[model samples]
Target: MTAVLFFLFAAAALAGALGVVLSRNPVHSALWLVLTLLSVAVFFLLQSAQLVAAVQVIVYAGAIVVLFLFVIMLLGVDREETLSDPIKLQRPAAIVLGVLMLGEVLVLAGHEWATGAQTAHGVPIHGLMDTGTDPGNNIERVARVLFTDFLWPFQLTAALLVVAVIGAIVLARRSGERPEDPGPGIPAAERARPGSGSGERPEADAETSEGTS
Candidate 1:
């Protein structure tokens, strides 16, 4: 059952990753990323790392992906008129790369799962719940190392993420706001129609029509 689940989620993770790369729409790519993150969280669960799985879902899928979507919406890129592949031999190249990636994954699967697998503190994290005395060992260990040893690096990464968000805002501001564009609730055609802005204008026009009649 474990093996079956592992393969299933591994396939899903691969598919999600491909979608993230192949998707032209930024929002679609972000949603694909969420699939990949969820698949990874499942892997952590299989490894008996509940806290890691929870963080993987909450921090990465929840917070980070939300931030990405927010930034993408703020950028507000216009959609392409055509979806055809513009580059020559793009499809062929993608197929070749995909086959190579599949071969690599197969090769890695043949080897022991322990090969090059370790936590940030170089501790092996294969089966924490199965081996550890306390059920909360994973959380305790992670918090200790994260706060004591890797705190500075963690804080730096967070600061960089904030900087990236601010940079996106700055870029959006440079593009300038399109105040002329109608709000989401209002139809653009309705906003542009003559005498739509003021109720008094319509009433005055009706009075003039009556007088002329």
Candidate 2:
């Protein structure tokens, strides 16, 4: 059962990662990234690292990805013109890096499997087997560690979130007010003036008929 779950999660993570790179639309790519993050959390859960899994879900999958989506939406990217053969070299490079990463992961997994490894508590580490006293207590232990020893990092993360929010707002805002133009009609004060050149001109007097006679 553990083997089956590990394979399933690994496949899901790979597929989601591929989708993130290959998807044309940025929104779809972001969604794919979310999926990839979720699969990673599942992998952590399978390894009995419940704390790491929770952090993966809360920080990466929840906060970071949501911020990415927010920025994407705020930018209002046009999906039609997004992936139209732009950045030709980037795609191949990304594929190569992804493949190399997958190879590294496989090698690491194999090495861990070969060794008779044990958790910090000296219990044998099986893929998905739970060897702890109470599975429910794992969350409590994680909370204690995070609040005690790791409190500084947690506070720093919160500060980073605040900065991100401010940066996003600044980036999205338009600078300065738009220029205004006077309307076609003359100004009220000018129209009120008697000889302001705005009102109708006086008619020209008729030619002096007496002088001609």
Candidate 3:
């Protein structure tokens, strides 16, 4: 049953990952990424890592992805016209990197499987839950190392993320507020609609002048 569940989630993860890469729309790609993250959380649950699974769902899928969607919304860049690939070599480079990653994954998987098979009878693979008295040993140990040795780096990463989000918001708002050029001597308001300003519509001003006289 465990093996069956693992394979199911593994397939879902793979499909979701492929969808993320293939989807043209950024929003659709982000939704596909949620699917991939959820599948990974399920895998963590199957491994008895409940804390990791919770963080995977709550922190990544919930907070981070929602923040991503917020930035996407703010940018308002979903139009098909704006979807052109600026860098010509980006697609080819991504394909090459993806292929290399796949090769590495295959090699690691084969090595682990062979080692596990060889030790199947003599030794058992003990996970964090099995080795320690505390059921939350994996999470605790990770938190210890993260907060102790990697605390500064972790805080720096968080600060960088915050700065990036602020920068995106500022750029989006600045672009939105910028007025398009409407030729020489055109008032910004009059440019919004033809003949709607004092200078643009002289006939209306002249009529008012005659009425006043």
Candidate 4:
């Protein structure tokens, strides 16, 4: 039954991941991302890692996806842009990198993969699987290994996130600046104010005799 559930969620995760890439609508892509994240949390649950699963659901699915949706909506979902690729060799580079990543997955699949031991950078819920005495054993053990063993990498990730946030704020400050032309749909009075000389807008009344009269 465990294997059955695992395969089911694994399929769902893969489908959701594909949907995220293939879906044209940003909102639909974000919903697909939520499914992928939830499936990953289920993977942790299958390993009896409740804390890690909760964090995955809460942090990635809840917070990160919400932020993504917020940004998508704020940028105006109705707006469309040209689908042309702006960067050179982008498609080829993506294909190459994707193939390399697939090769890595196949390599790992051939190896004997197990939990309850330290992963490449992060440790699993070994404490939970080993001892039933302590309720917070999983939390304590994982936190200790993460802080001591993978502290530098964690710090680097945090610094990168901080830098991204700062860059977003700087860009947001420029959103208010727009073109001076209102682009149609304005009252005649607002467009042409009284007591203003024709020199203020030579283009507006170029053929009229108001200024010449």
**Number of the top candidate by lDDT?**
1
Candidate 4 per-residue C-alpha lDDT over 44-157 given as tens digits, one digit per residue, 9 for 90 to 100 = 877767789999999999899998988797767835435778998898899999999999887775565533233443533342255445555678867877899999999999
**Cα-based TM-score, every candidate:** 0.57, 0.57, 0.57, 0.58
lDDT of 4 at 50: 74
Cα lDDT tens digits for candidate 1, 1-213: 677788899999999999998788888899999999999999998888789899889999999999788767765852443677799899899899989999999878555563554343354445435636553577787787789999999999999987765554333321113344332333445445633443333433334333432
Compose the digit string of candidate 3's lDDT tens values, residues 1-213. Answer: 677777899999999999887887879888999999999998887766777899999999999899788768767976444556799989889889989999988787668564565545444334335534554467787788789999999999999987775454333321213454333443455545543343434444344333432
Return the lDDT, model 3, position 125. 32
Q: Which stretches of candidate 2 lie above 4 Å from their native place?
A: 81-136, 177-213
Model 3 residue 20 CA deviation (Å) reads: 1.3
lDDT of each: 0.70, 0.67, 0.70, 0.70
- Candidate 1 vs candidate 4: the TM-score winner is 4
Tell me the deviation in Å of residue 153 in model 2: 3.2
lDDT assessment of candidate 1: 0.70
Full-model lDDT, candidate 4: 0.70
- Model 1: residue 186 alpha-carbon error in angstroms: 25
